[model samples]
Target: MGEHCDDEQVVVKKLVNKRYLLFKIDLFVLSFVCLQYWINYVDRVGFVNAYISGMKEDLQFKNNDINVANTCFTVGYILGMIPNNLILLVAPPRVWLSFCTFAWGLLTLGMFKVTSFEQCCAIRFFQALFESCTFSGTHLILGSWYKESELPIRSAIFTSSGLIGSMFSGFMQVAIHDSLNGVRGLEGWRWLFIIDFSITMPIALYGFLFFPGVPEHSSGKSRFSMTKYFFSEQELQYARRRLPARDESTRLDWSVVPRVLKRWHWWFFSFVWVLGGENLSLASNSTFALWLKDQQYSLSHRNNFPSGIFAVGVVSTMLSAVYLYKVARSRHWHVATFIAVIMCIVAIMIRANPIKPSVMFTAQYLGGVAYAGQAVFFAWANIVCHDDLQERAIVLASMNMFSGAVNAWWSILFFAATTVPHFEKGSYALLATSISSGLVSVWIRKLQNRDSSRKQKLSYIDANDMLDEDDDDDDDDDEYDDQIAQNHS
Candidate 1:
């Protein structure tokens, strides 16, 4: 009787321990990813702050050269994204991603010596190349660890960290400009890069030690090594089954590409995120603050004010994450996108109209919620594609790559140097895209719901003839895999 009682106690203790572990991976792992993203944005924006502080004068950048530099960085990001994702599949994210992080930190520190426009452009180019791994890579990590129900809010929290980073950069710049302007004979801009590099070094070291490579390839005694980290028993089984057995070999099956691309959901998400990407560029790139400073606003006011947009982003993202987690099964993502579209339209309207700076700030803050919509949208894709590994990867990368490519030109053409204070054309384009984004979101949700219903029907029929149907399904999957491999070859 005492032995049985002790066994009961052990079981209870295991259950309790698992419950505590429920949120550990999400909280710490997500926060770690957020810190990386935060630092990524901080480094990207340090150049912007430096430009405002006097880097433009010291570097003798032409009026259009800053735009040229930004364009170059975006180009590098776009070029690297797809290939980097492929490499991520082959390499453990921990080893490759941490190395990338450290390399970029060193590159960011090297920004201190950039004296000409060409030098600045070159560093920014390589910086974007190295830093491109964090965004979609984190999304992939979140998808690996969390269930569909738990993904949206977690991903939003992750994405919002970038905005938080952007917000914090303003405060950090203010402190740096005031305190480090001429310390050690280095100018404020030099200190900005130096400090930015310093902040990321520790995070990279943490990642090297901690980040689980891929969910299926976890090493012994790490955070995700335990069975409790998976959402369901079946999920744990699925992760185990993804790895090859002792007699089997693990190789890149190039054939998975067509299977991924053939899905309608992939294209829909890519299109949706293309619009969503514009929101980040408009708000998160320090454009609003830079525009305000260009109009001669005091540095104190400029720094303090733009952060309100991130505050709004945090609230909206948390709310949307909760909403999706609760009602995503019913296909309610369009509702969130609809609301974001409306807010964006209102922002465009305010930009078009002459308004008080405070009112304009309010408009921009409200529009910041649209940024959360992108997070929700991408997380939704991860949910829809959760069962298909290659599909999930391709969809996530394509969404970001297309968005980056679009924003690359969009920023130069619409939100150019001359469009400050109003950005009439840019506002109009945003308004148009906002409306289109809402429409596409609604349509895609409808299509996905239909597809889900079809899949559910098929599952119900198969359940009645379990063994026969299971064998057939396995055969079908193998055949599909072969077809995909052939297409790739």
Candidate 2:
């Protein structure tokens, strides 16, 4: 009993130390990563805010020109995914991500110089290539720092931070429109770019100084040595010990091609996000702003009204994250989007038959539930592919990449700003895509269950027990599976 008590005390000591280390990670790492998302979102979506505030008038954007420019951002987004993942692997995130952030801020300021649609498109394409790392790259980094159980809410918080930025952009635009319209000899919309650039510079510098790289590589690197100020060598070792062993680092090679192709994860997760992103078009493409524009609401309304969707987004994203955190399955990830699909269906009904403005607006607001799936599916990918770092990186990036690939044209086909009032075709497209996404989620669950069962049957054997001494070997996955089952807590 005395020995047992001593052991218990040792375990308690470790837990206390581990909690301290976790608090530091939450403070420094998650906070900066979340800020990166928030700023990236503000800069990325601020275009629409500025557009509605005054740029549409200044730039003389007509017909579908806004849609065309937005498509260029998505094109650059898709192009950046694979390469950005490669960059994160080779370079410290402190350098790679912050440089990208700073570059986009510079591009945001460059918006002031653009006088034509072609120039605007060119700038957005480059800005997007820089900003593209914010989402998937953070997910890749988050997966490195967090255990599966701890990830969902953190992912939710991170995902919702971008929504908060989207929400803030509207209010910021409204404020700028009122106060800064003619300041510094620039239009209110141009001032928006100037202010956005101003805000992004400090954040870029902050990330460069403080962003902690992943634990596996942090030790013994000249760049990361200073990070020891926040976490001691002992705590860093504990951070590693608390998680699974790292996979061997290998150079990017053709060997990864066949390995990824053989796996179900890369296929299913990537494809699901593509459909899900399309299905969420109403929120993704700023349908509320479009509706306000068609109704000829004032600039104030355009800037203030779209924020309602963003507000709904916070609640739905948080609630959905809580549910998925508790349940811990990709099978349930589609629920939020499914609710949005119902809203789309109801929206179609209202459009076909005349309804009060309040009723249709309510339906559109409910579609913010679709944004909740962002945290859900991304967290799911992290949970399922927790063991393989490279595969996880590729899969996370591909999920966003394929989704952006689809979105490159999704807005054009469905949520084109010109189609704002009724958007009959868009409603139909969303309905179809949402249904397809739900089916895909169900299929992914079926596949996971099949794989889990096969692995369980095979887990009874010990690979290590049969191995010879001093030979390099793979860790037994049975232990990983068991720990993972409990990680949802």
Identify the leading candidate in terms of TM-score.
2
Question: Weakest 10 consecutive residues, lDDT, candidate 2?
Answer: 458-467
Could you give candidate 2's per-residue lDDT for residues 1-489 as a string of tens digits? 999999976544442244567788898789888898998888888899988887888889999999899999999999999899878987888788889999999999999777888899999999999988989999988888876656777998999899999988888989988998888778888888888999899988888777777776663345643576677555665565555454566446777787677999999999988877876677778777877877889999888887888788889888876775555353454564465466557546546742357866777777777777888888888877765777888999999999999888889987787786787787778777777787788788778777766653323232223324322232443344455454331
How many clashes would you count in candidate 1?
2
Regions of model 1 farther than 4 Å from truth: 1-17, 221-252, 326-332, 456-489
Candidate 2 lDDT for residue 441? 83
Candidate 1 to truth, TM:
0.83
What local lDDT does model 1 show for residue 184?
93
Candidate 1 lowest-lDDT run of ten: 458-467
